[model samples]
Target chain A: MTDTIAIGTADRKDAKTGTVAANRALAGPRVNGKAVVMTLYLVFLMLPIYWLVNMSLKTNTEITSGLTLWPRQITFDNYIRIFTDQSWYSGYINSLTYVVINTVLSISFALPAAYAFSRYRFLGDKHLFFWLLTNRMAPPAVFALPFFNLYSAIGLFDTPWAVALAHCLFNIPLAVWILEGFMSGVPREIDETAAIDGYSFPRFFVKIFMPLIASGIGVAAFFCFMFSWVELLLARTLTTVNAKPIAATMTRTISASGMDWGMLAAAGVLTIVPGALVIWFVRNYIAKGFALGRV
Target chain B: MTKTLNNKAWFLVLPVFAIVAFSAVLPLMTVVNYSVQDTFGNNQFFWNGIGWFQELLDPSKELGGRFFEALWRTLLFSAIILAIEIPLGILVALSMPREGWTVALCLVLMALPLLIPWNVVGTIWQVFARGDIGLLGWVVNHLGIDYNYTGDALDAWATIIVMDVWHWTSLVALLCYAGLKSIPDAYYQAARIDGASRWAVFRTIQLPKMRRVLLIAVLLRFMDSFMIYTEPFVLTGGGPGNATTFLSIDLVKLALGQFDLGKAAALSLVYNLIILAICWVFYTVMTNVDADRERVEA
Candidate 1:
């Protein structure tokens, strides 16, 4: 338990102010064992991702008949198909549009709820907080069938907005939960300080408290976008071929004609890039936000 | 705007409620309505009361598993995941470089596996596990492991568990690493003055500090493992038999495969109830742990 807490809290302050000597001192042979272990773990982690990228750059014949560490001849046909074709790029746009919308909407709604729960005592506040999390606990399958039926009946089915709406079921809970972490990190004194200055509660929240948790919100948004960008079950049900996400689009490669392994791999490689880019830009936030969200 | 009571918080909560009502609550109400009633073609319906629920509860029904079998399996799965991940994640976090460019590289690369869609994960493993062409299958065969996940139940279950571990362990590791990084140097200094052993220091100092975060990790992991569907769905299709079939898979088979909305809805409600109950326990335990930590600190 203490280990878990240490890891979670140590995350935010770990911008490494240590001297190179101290850092290198820990990297001696004993530590190298751990690093080697970590390296093996990394290799275990990257092999499949590399395979996806490898296959993506190859032709169907190459993918089916032979196996190689790297593609003999790199090709952009798969990527070209994704950009030029309707089904391919449509998934990207639909996913990105909703992902952005969901991220923004989730924060907008969850910020206040998280703040209320974090800073104040009110009627049914605890229950409401728990209620928010109930959405997160339920299985996606439990909701998928009903969501499909309900969305179809209400004429909201088969739209990107519908996917965005369905996504909120999970994303809102996550946003609220993570934002609550950030809000909790800010001492209640900050709110009272702003209050003492005659700043309105609303004004204080937007001006004072928001900045304190800006990093937290960024962390939460990164997670929301990451999860939404990668989700497939809800993405699959909410859209057909027209609005299907790239992940779902790859499923078509399994048709009876034969497996389009090369094209599918290419798509898979493309799919991973957005996530990698986002993580690259926000690695610190991710390292911090992950602790709040999970640990 | 005043301290007395700013009711404007309702405005923020209202959208969440509305969105949930239309999306989650309304659909749930529809499920509740369906659960108690039967439906015919053209959406004709009849009141079936608790008949479906009772039948589900009955042991004779093949679908009606013995009470603890499914429940125990679920619990066992959650336990296995928590036990493996919490320890392994901690170890990984502890091993991570305290700070540097390498940390960023490691974090980004570590997160890559998690960013892939669950189905894509399943697909990747599916192709990668093929005996004829898949590297994993070919290597295992060469080593004479007789590894056939598609045909054997235990193998399938083990494979699924391993795959899940691969997909999710990073979450626990990353979280733990963050928590580990947060300890003030003062604590370590005090421990050093006391001539504390590494194990003692870790147990007495670091572990206690991480309780709140660990609680969160456990709950999130429990809920996630309990609700998992897509990866296993795509990976094994809940086969070679029913070995890897979890409640989520069963629910889908009932609802979508058979289109038995009444029964499936009842099952789903029960499903939600079980999840809610587990999460409730998890949250209570977490909050309790937090309270205990506060008392100790105070």
Candidate 2:
């Protein structure tokens, strides 16, 4: 399927060059319109983020005093404070810890299950798959209190493990769903060939099959990381102090003195960095991943 | 693809099953337990079967009124989000550059909003839409339309809806772009040869080709919007007067704030059931659509 799309793209490139004059005449206005639409939409998307970044660079007094598109007196005090303070910087560490754990856990657990669903017809497989998907739809609000009790009773509360494990409620299902889609796209002949080659199931899976779906695994892990990092409700509820996510710690921006606009904007800006970094790593797979590999 | 029957495959699935069951089932059981029973301070409990559920469903009761109001508001919010996002997403996806370095740049920037923490998204909008300092709020006020999300219920609703659109529309667009990418140039060539109008090509070819991804996008948007909590909570704190208190906000208040476990549990169960029902419908439709497409191809 992907091969056909690649071929089609090459064909379009050839066609564009081949009929340059005629094609340009026909598509000129439409192309310009597309560029305009894209520019406007991208601007709409970036303006708010630009505002946040703008505020983060300014002093608290300047932030409250007036609106500024660009900071007149840029100061690093907010970023400096976050990096220097133990409480502030620790939140980022804590958030990264659980997000990493959850992504690893979700992808590892989902891998075998996804392979099973894709490669075999097991007892109640369809029902099981659907049931798993239903978990993705379960509201985090419904699970917050119960998770708090369950984790505390198990002595995992107020720890990164609690949030990581709790996050599995949704992330596992999602990983399995995405991985299954990617796995199903691979031909069954490969599995049969491996068997004919006298390969053990585990060896075939790890050495041969795993490499084939490496991008799928990357996509799944990316999604797992994205969800676990951004989720605040369960993360905040499960951990009060020691494992507080950067997002939860962000609430501290509301101090007794008043809202610390600069620090709040700084923390918000900082939260976007890890995500942006992750997106950069997975940029190629993102569109396909967002399709959950069904396409 | 064909699969061999192998019940033994369950072994491969056991780890996921165990972990998910531990995470999902155990907490779910706790919710069920809370739903049936009343609890006093120090966890003293009494039987309260059907009582909380009844109160939750009965509009005359205060609990029921709040639940129904939030449910309607949430449903309306989800509906409006879908109505706006799906069309806008398709437009953006259609406008995406077909090739070159800009593709990666567009995708990376488009995905940035999706990865931001929900509360940060709220904060961005909250700060961006403030009347005094927020660029959007300041600009809108400068236009001489009295716009204060902090004070006006209608403005609060609009701010939240717009914020959600900003955050999630990228997801829909990205999915649709994938769907569009999969279409072979042969289809376009054929349409061009036939001298088909752009709308004709889109209606007859692009839309049908995009059906699968669109369904996925719709299902995700609906579920996420319906369950939205952190963004609106941070942005409006459920508002000037419960104007933006969706289901999750109300549930958090009931469960955590008031410590009303029974009512919260009941609401949670009902809420889960509604989502489950909608999800089942979408799943059934998706499978049927897949089967139909397969049959047509065959």
Docking class of 1: acceptable
Candidates' RMSD to native: 5.9, 3.9
* Candidate 2 C-alpha lDDT tens digits along B1-298: 6689999999999999999989889999999999999988797999998999999999999999999999999999999999999999999999999888999999999999999999899999999999998999999999999999989999999999999999999999999999999999889777665545567779999999899999999999999999999999999999889999999999999999999999999999999999999999999999999889878978
Model 1 global lDDT (CA atoms, 0 to 1):
0.77
Model 2, span A37-91: residue lDDT tens: 9999999999999999999999999988877789999999999999999999999
lDDT of each: 0.77, 0.93
Model 2 chain B lDDT-worst window of ten: B189-198
lDDT of 1 by residue, A1-295 (tens): 4544543333322325433343332223435677887898888887767777777788877777766768888888888987998877887787788788888888888888787666666666668778878887778887888888877887878777778888889898889888887787677777778888999978988888888888988898888888788777887887775567778878888883877777777777777788888888888777678877433
Q: How well is candidate 1 docked (DockQ)?
A: 0.38
TM-score of the first chain alone, every candidate: 0.86, 0.91
